[model samples]
Target: MKPIITTERLIIRELQPDDAAGIFRLDSNPAVHEYLGKSPITTIEEAQNAISFIRKQYETNGIGRWAMVLKDTNEFIGWTGLKLINTEEVNGHRNFYDLGYRLVQEHWRKGYGFEAAKACLDYAFSVMKLEKVYANAEKGNTGSNTILQKLQPVHTESFWDEGVETIWFEFQNNKIGS
Candidate 1:
Protein backbone atom coordinates (compact mmCIF):
# COMPACT_ATOMS: atom_id res chain seq x y z
CA MET A 1 0.00 0.00 0.00
CA LYS A 2 1.30 3.45 -0.87
CA PRO A 3 -0.22 4.97 2.30
CA ILE A 4 -1.32 8.08 0.46
CA ILE A 5 -4.87 9.39 0.45
CA THR A 6 -5.39 12.56 -1.52
CA THR A 7 -8.37 14.78 -1.01
CA GLU A 8 -9.36 18.11 -2.54
CA ARG A 9 -7.19 20.16 -0.17
CA LEU A 10 -5.34 17.62 1.92
CA ILE A 11 -3.10 14.61 1.68
CA ILE A 12 -3.43 11.88 4.25
CA ARG A 13 -0.50 9.49 4.48
CA GLU A 14 1.80 7.61 6.78
CA LEU A 15 4.39 9.46 8.81
CA GLN A 16 7.90 9.61 7.38
CA PRO A 17 11.23 9.90 9.13
CA ASP A 18 11.63 13.45 7.84
CA ASP A 19 8.30 14.41 9.39
CA ALA A 20 9.80 14.38 12.88
CA ALA A 21 10.34 18.12 12.95
CA GLY A 22 6.85 18.90 11.77
CA ILE A 23 5.33 16.40 14.16
CA PHE A 24 7.45 17.91 16.93
CA ARG A 25 6.06 21.34 16.15
CA LEU A 26 2.49 20.08 16.28
CA ASP A 27 3.10 18.08 19.43
CA SER A 28 4.94 20.90 21.17
CA ASN A 29 2.22 23.48 20.81
CA PRO A 30 0.59 23.88 24.20
CA ALA A 31 -2.65 25.20 22.73
CA VAL A 32 -2.98 22.14 20.58
CA HIS A 33 -2.36 19.84 23.51
CA GLU A 34 -4.75 21.60 25.87
CA TYR A 35 -7.60 19.12 25.45
CA LEU A 36 -5.27 16.22 24.74
CA GLY A 37 -4.75 15.44 28.42
CA LYS A 38 -1.02 16.16 28.45
CA SER A 39 1.57 18.81 27.86
CA PRO A 40 3.17 19.41 24.52
CA ILE A 41 6.06 17.19 23.59
CA THR A 42 9.40 18.95 24.04
CA THR A 43 11.75 16.95 21.84
CA ILE A 44 12.19 15.69 18.30
CA GLU A 45 13.17 12.37 19.81
CA GLU A 46 9.65 11.96 21.13
CA ALA A 47 8.24 12.68 17.70
CA GLN A 48 10.56 10.14 16.19
CA ASN A 49 9.42 7.59 18.74
CA ALA A 50 5.82 8.35 17.89
CA ILE A 51 6.51 7.85 14.21
CA SER A 52 8.07 4.47 14.87
CA PHE A 53 5.15 3.44 17.00
CA ILE A 54 2.60 4.48 14.35
CA ARG A 55 4.48 2.62 11.66
CA LYS A 56 4.54 -0.46 13.82
CA GLN A 57 0.79 -0.26 14.22
CA TYR A 58 0.35 -0.18 10.43
CA GLU A 59 2.62 -3.15 10.02
CA THR A 60 0.94 -5.25 12.66
CA ASN A 61 -2.67 -4.24 12.20
CA GLY A 62 -2.84 -3.03 8.56
CA ILE A 63 -4.30 0.27 9.78
CA GLY A 64 -3.13 3.23 11.81
CA ARG A 65 -3.20 6.99 12.10
CA TRP A 66 -2.07 9.05 9.08
CA ALA A 67 -0.25 12.35 8.87
CA MET A 68 -2.27 15.12 7.22
CA VAL A 69 -0.64 17.59 4.84
CA LEU A 70 -2.09 20.66 3.28
CA LYS A 71 -2.13 20.18 -0.47
CA ASP A 72 -1.43 23.74 -1.53
CA THR A 73 1.50 24.26 0.81
CA ASN A 74 2.50 20.64 1.39
CA GLU A 75 2.92 21.53 5.02
CA PHE A 76 2.24 19.00 7.73
CA ILE A 77 -0.90 20.15 9.51
CA GLY A 78 -1.67 17.19 11.76
CA TRP A 79 -2.99 13.62 11.61
CA THR A 80 -6.23 11.65 11.21
CA GLY A 81 -7.00 7.98 10.89
CA LEU A 82 -8.16 4.76 12.52
CA LYS A 83 -6.95 3.23 15.74
CA LEU A 84 -7.80 0.11 17.73
CA ILE A 85 -8.88 1.28 21.13
CA ASN A 86 -9.85 -0.27 24.44
CA THR A 87 -13.64 -0.40 24.48
CA GLU A 88 -14.14 -3.60 26.45
CA GLU A 89 -14.89 -1.96 29.74
CA VAL A 90 -16.99 0.79 28.23
CA ASN A 91 -18.92 -1.13 25.60
CA GLY A 92 -18.33 -4.76 26.47
CA HIS A 93 -16.08 -5.30 23.51
CA ARG A 94 -12.44 -6.22 23.58
CA ASN A 95 -11.27 -4.66 20.30
CA PHE A 96 -12.95 -1.76 18.53
CA TYR A 97 -11.89 0.75 15.92
CA ASP A 98 -12.00 4.49 16.45
CA LEU A 99 -11.64 7.50 14.18
CA GLY A 100 -9.49 10.36 15.42
CA TYR A 101 -7.82 13.59 14.33
CA ARG A 102 -5.60 16.34 15.76
CA LEU A 103 -4.41 19.50 14.04
CA VAL A 104 -1.98 22.24 14.97
CA GLN A 105 -3.20 25.42 16.57
CA GLU A 106 -2.89 27.46 13.40
CA HIS A 107 -5.23 25.09 11.61
CA TRP A 108 -7.92 25.35 14.22
CA ARG A 109 -11.32 26.84 13.29
CA LYS A 110 -10.89 25.68 9.73
CA GLY A 111 -12.79 22.70 8.29
CA TYR A 112 -9.65 20.57 8.18
CA GLY A 113 -10.66 18.42 11.11
CA PHE A 114 -13.89 17.47 9.43
CA GLU A 115 -12.29 17.06 6.04
CA ALA A 116 -9.53 14.79 7.21
CA ALA A 117 -11.78 12.87 9.58
CA LYS A 118 -14.41 12.29 6.91
CA ALA A 119 -11.76 10.92 4.62
CA CYS A 120 -10.61 8.53 7.32
CA LEU A 121 -14.15 7.44 7.95
CA ASP A 122 -14.57 6.72 4.27
CA TYR A 123 -11.44 4.62 4.28
CA ALA A 124 -12.51 2.74 7.36
CA PHE A 125 -15.99 1.90 6.12
CA SER A 126 -15.41 1.59 2.38
CA VAL A 127 -11.87 0.33 2.06
CA MET A 128 -11.24 -1.45 5.32
CA LYS A 129 -14.71 -3.01 5.47
CA LEU A 130 -15.22 -1.89 9.02
CA GLU A 131 -18.81 -1.85 10.17
CA LYS A 132 -18.47 0.85 12.79
CA VAL A 133 -16.22 3.59 14.11
CA TYR A 134 -16.28 5.29 17.49
CA ALA A 135 -14.99 8.63 18.72
CA ASN A 136 -14.66 10.52 22.01
CA ALA A 137 -14.07 14.14 22.78
CA GLU A 138 -13.63 16.13 25.95
CA LYS A 139 -17.00 17.32 27.19
CA GLY A 140 -16.32 20.93 26.43
CA ASN A 141 -14.95 20.35 22.92
CA THR A 142 -17.90 21.81 21.09
CA GLY A 143 -16.02 21.92 17.82
CA SER A 144 -15.25 18.23 17.94
CA ASN A 145 -18.79 17.37 18.84
CA THR A 146 -20.09 19.44 15.98
CA ILE A 147 -17.90 17.74 13.43
CA LEU A 148 -18.82 14.33 14.78
CA GLN A 149 -22.49 15.26 14.67
CA LYS A 150 -22.17 15.83 10.95
CA LEU A 151 -21.26 12.20 10.66
CA GLN A 152 -24.44 11.21 12.49
CA PRO A 153 -22.69 8.95 14.98
CA VAL A 154 -24.81 7.70 17.82
CA HIS A 155 -24.19 9.60 21.01
CA THR A 156 -23.37 6.80 23.36
CA GLU A 157 -22.68 8.21 26.80
CA SER A 158 -20.93 10.80 28.87
CA PHE A 159 -18.54 9.75 31.58
CA TRP A 160 -16.30 11.52 34.03
CA ASP A 161 -12.80 10.28 34.58
CA GLU A 162 -9.97 11.95 36.43
CA GLY A 163 -11.89 15.21 36.64
CA VAL A 164 -12.62 15.45 32.91
CA GLU A 165 -15.83 14.33 31.24
CA THR A 166 -15.84 12.89 27.71
CA ILE A 167 -18.71 12.46 25.25
CA TRP A 168 -18.63 9.29 23.23
CA PHE A 169 -19.94 8.97 19.66
CA GLU A 170 -20.40 5.93 17.49
CA PHE A 171 -21.11 5.44 13.74
CA GLN A 172 -22.32 2.07 12.79
CA ASN A 173 -22.72 -0.18 9.71
CA ASN A 174 -25.59 1.53 7.93
CA LYS A 175 -24.25 4.98 7.23
CA ILE A 176 -21.09 4.42 5.21
CA GLY A 177 -20.79 6.34 1.92
CA SER A 178 -24.27 7.71 2.43
Candidate 2:
Protein backbone atom coordinates (compact mmCIF):
# COMPACT_ATOMS: atom_id res chain seq x y z
CA MET A 1 0.00 0.00 0.00
CA LYS A 2 1.10 3.55 -0.70
CA PRO A 3 2.22 5.35 2.40
CA ILE A 4 0.26 8.43 3.32
CA ILE A 5 3.28 9.73 5.21
CA THR A 6 6.83 8.47 5.27
CA THR A 7 9.49 9.19 7.84
CA GLU A 8 13.13 8.23 7.88
CA ARG A 9 12.34 4.87 9.51
CA LEU A 10 8.58 4.48 9.31
CA ILE A 11 5.79 4.41 6.78
CA ILE A 12 2.39 5.59 7.85
CA ARG A 13 -0.54 4.18 5.90
CA GLU A 14 -4.16 3.18 6.22
CA LEU A 15 -4.82 0.27 8.56
CA GLN A 16 -5.62 -2.93 6.68
CA PRO A 17 -7.52 -6.13 7.52
CA ASP A 18 -4.28 -8.08 7.49
CA ASP A 19 -2.99 -5.90 10.32
CA ALA A 20 -5.27 -7.60 12.81
CA ALA A 21 -2.42 -9.65 14.25
CA GLY A 22 -0.27 -6.60 14.78
CA ILE A 23 -3.15 -4.74 16.31
CA PHE A 24 -3.76 -7.62 18.65
CA ARG A 25 -0.13 -7.68 19.65
CA LEU A 26 -0.24 -3.99 20.43
CA ASP A 27 -3.60 -3.76 22.22
CA SER A 28 -3.14 -6.95 24.17
CA ASN A 29 -0.16 -5.64 26.06
CA PRO A 30 -1.22 -4.43 29.50
CA ALA A 31 1.75 -2.08 29.70
CA VAL A 32 0.64 -0.28 26.54
CA HIS A 33 -2.84 0.39 27.93
CA GLU A 34 -1.61 1.40 31.38
CA TYR A 35 -2.37 5.05 30.75
CA LEU A 36 -4.91 4.66 27.95
CA GLY A 37 -7.52 3.79 30.59
CA LYS A 38 -8.75 0.97 28.35
CA SER A 39 -8.68 -2.76 28.89
CA PRO A 40 -6.41 -5.03 26.89
CA ILE A 41 -7.96 -7.19 24.19
CA THR A 42 -8.01 -10.99 24.66
CA THR A 43 -8.77 -12.09 21.13
CA ILE A 44 -7.73 -11.49 17.54
CA GLU A 45 -11.41 -11.03 16.69
CA GLU A 46 -11.48 -7.96 18.89
CA ALA A 47 -8.50 -6.56 17.04
CA GLN A 48 -10.21 -7.17 13.70
CA ASN A 49 -13.26 -5.34 15.01
CA ALA A 50 -11.03 -2.47 16.04
CA ILE A 51 -9.50 -2.32 12.59
CA SER A 52 -12.96 -2.32 11.02
CA PHE A 53 -14.00 0.57 13.22
CA ILE A 54 -10.88 2.56 12.29
CA ARG A 55 -11.41 1.82 8.60
CA LYS A 56 -14.99 3.07 8.90
CA GLN A 57 -13.63 6.30 10.34
CA TYR A 58 -11.58 6.77 7.20
CA GLU A 59 -14.72 6.37 5.07
CA THR A 60 -17.08 8.33 7.33
CA ASN A 61 -14.77 11.06 8.56
CA GLY A 62 -12.11 11.27 5.82
CA ILE A 63 -9.33 10.41 8.28
CA GLY A 64 -8.33 7.86 10.87
CA ARG A 65 -5.32 6.33 12.56
CA TRP A 66 -3.01 4.64 10.07
CA ALA A 67 -0.70 1.73 10.64
CA MET A 68 2.92 2.53 11.43
CA VAL A 69 5.33 0.18 9.71
CA LEU A 70 9.08 -0.18 9.72
CA LYS A 71 10.61 1.08 6.51
CA ASP A 72 13.39 -1.51 6.43
CA THR A 73 11.49 -4.69 7.30
CA ASN A 74 7.87 -3.81 6.48
CA GLU A 75 6.73 -4.68 9.98
CA PHE A 76 3.54 -3.28 11.41
CA ILE A 77 4.73 -1.35 14.44
CA GLY A 78 1.41 0.14 15.47
CA TRP A 79 -0.85 3.05 14.39
CA THR A 80 -0.44 6.77 14.14
CA GLY A 81 -2.41 9.58 12.51
CA LEU A 82 -5.45 11.82 13.00
CA LYS A 83 -8.95 11.07 14.18
CA LEU A 84 -11.91 13.37 13.60
CA ILE A 85 -13.68 13.75 16.91
CA ASN A 86 -17.25 14.73 16.06
CA THR A 87 -19.24 12.18 17.98
CA GLU A 88 -18.03 13.10 21.45
CA GLU A 89 -16.65 16.04 23.36
CA VAL A 90 -13.16 15.87 24.79
CA ASN A 91 -11.95 18.58 27.13
CA GLY A 92 -15.13 20.51 26.19
CA HIS A 93 -14.35 20.44 22.49
CA ARG A 94 -15.93 18.53 19.63
CA ASN A 95 -15.59 18.19 15.88
CA PHE A 96 -11.85 18.55 16.05
CA TYR A 97 -8.87 16.67 14.69
CA ASP A 98 -6.76 14.76 17.24
CA LEU A 99 -3.27 13.32 16.86
CA GLY A 100 -2.59 9.87 18.28
CA TYR A 101 -0.11 6.98 18.08
CA ARG A 102 0.32 3.50 19.53
CA LEU A 103 3.25 1.12 19.19
CA VAL A 104 4.06 -2.45 20.00
CA GLN A 105 5.50 -2.97 23.48
CA GLU A 106 8.97 -3.77 22.23
CA HIS A 107 8.93 -0.65 20.10
CA TRP A 108 8.25 1.67 23.01
CA ARG A 109 10.83 4.33 23.98
CA LYS A 110 12.66 4.04 20.68
CA GLY A 111 11.46 7.47 19.41
CA TYR A 112 8.97 5.93 16.93
CA GLY A 113 6.03 7.55 18.69
CA PHE A 114 7.44 11.02 18.28
CA GLU A 115 8.61 10.38 14.75
CA ALA A 116 5.18 9.14 13.64
CA ALA A 117 3.31 11.83 15.55
CA LYS A 118 5.39 14.67 14.13
CA ALA A 119 4.81 13.37 10.61
CA CYS A 120 1.06 13.16 11.20
CA LEU A 121 0.99 16.64 12.70
CA ASP A 122 2.76 17.98 9.66
CA TYR A 123 0.31 16.19 7.37
CA ALA A 124 -2.70 17.48 9.29
CA PHE A 125 -1.52 21.03 8.90
CA SER A 126 -0.14 20.92 5.38
CA VAL A 127 -2.03 18.38 3.31
CA MET A 128 -5.27 18.44 5.26
CA LYS A 129 -5.24 22.21 5.76
CA LEU A 130 -6.46 21.79 9.27
CA GLU A 131 -6.41 24.89 11.41
CA LYS A 132 -5.54 23.06 14.59
CA VAL A 133 -4.92 19.63 16.07
CA TYR A 134 -5.45 18.50 19.62
CA ALA A 135 -3.73 15.79 21.62
CA ASN A 136 -4.02 14.53 25.17
CA ALA A 137 -1.91 12.27 27.32
CA GLU A 138 -2.51 10.91 30.73
CA LYS A 139 -0.62 12.99 33.27
CA GLY A 140 1.46 10.04 34.36
CA ASN A 141 2.49 8.96 30.91
CA THR A 142 5.68 10.93 30.87
CA GLY A 143 6.81 9.67 27.48
CA SER A 144 3.65 10.73 25.70
CA ASN A 145 3.38 14.00 27.57
CA THR A 146 6.95 14.83 26.59
CA ILE A 147 6.36 14.14 22.92
CA LEU A 148 3.31 16.39 22.86
CA GLN A 149 5.35 19.12 24.45
CA LYS A 150 8.00 18.77 21.77
CA LEU A 151 5.38 19.44 19.07
CA GLN A 152 5.08 22.93 20.61
CA PRO A 153 1.33 23.29 20.79
CA VAL A 154 -0.10 26.79 21.10
CA HIS A 155 -2.13 26.17 24.24
CA THR A 156 -2.40 23.57 26.96
CA GLU A 157 -4.55 22.70 29.94
CA SER A 158 -5.21 19.97 32.41
CA PHE A 159 -8.55 18.24 32.59
CA TRP A 160 -10.21 15.22 34.11
CA ASP A 161 -11.12 12.26 31.97
CA GLU A 162 -12.80 9.46 33.82
CA GLY A 163 -11.08 10.43 37.05
CA VAL A 164 -7.67 10.55 35.44
CA GLU A 165 -5.81 13.81 35.09
CA THR A 166 -4.91 14.41 31.49
CA ILE A 167 -3.03 17.18 29.71
CA TRP A 168 -4.62 18.56 26.55
CA PHE A 169 -2.55 20.27 23.88
CA GLU A 170 -3.62 22.40 20.94
CA PHE A 171 -1.36 22.94 17.96
CA GLN A 172 -2.25 25.67 15.52
CA ASN A 173 -1.19 25.36 11.93
CA ASN A 174 0.93 28.45 12.28
CA LYS A 175 2.52 27.57 15.60
CA ILE A 176 3.52 23.95 15.08
CA GLY A 177 7.25 23.07 15.42
CA SER A 178 7.88 26.67 16.40
The best candidate by TM-score is 2
lDDT of 1 by residue, 1-178 (tens): 1546888899999988888988998999987887888788999999999999989988887778889998898899998899886534544444788889988888988999998888888888777888888888888888888788888775568876567888888887657332
Please identify model 2 stretches exceeding 4 Å from their true place.
Answer: none
TM value for model 1 = 0.91
lDDT of each: 0.83, 0.94
Q: Name the lDDT of candidate 1.
A: 0.83
lDDT of 2 by residue, 1-178 (tens): 9999999999999999999999999999999999987699999999999999999999999999999999999999999999999999999999999999999989989999999988998898889999999999999999999889988989999999999999999998867662
Candidate number of the best lDDT: 2
TM-score of each: 0.91, 0.98
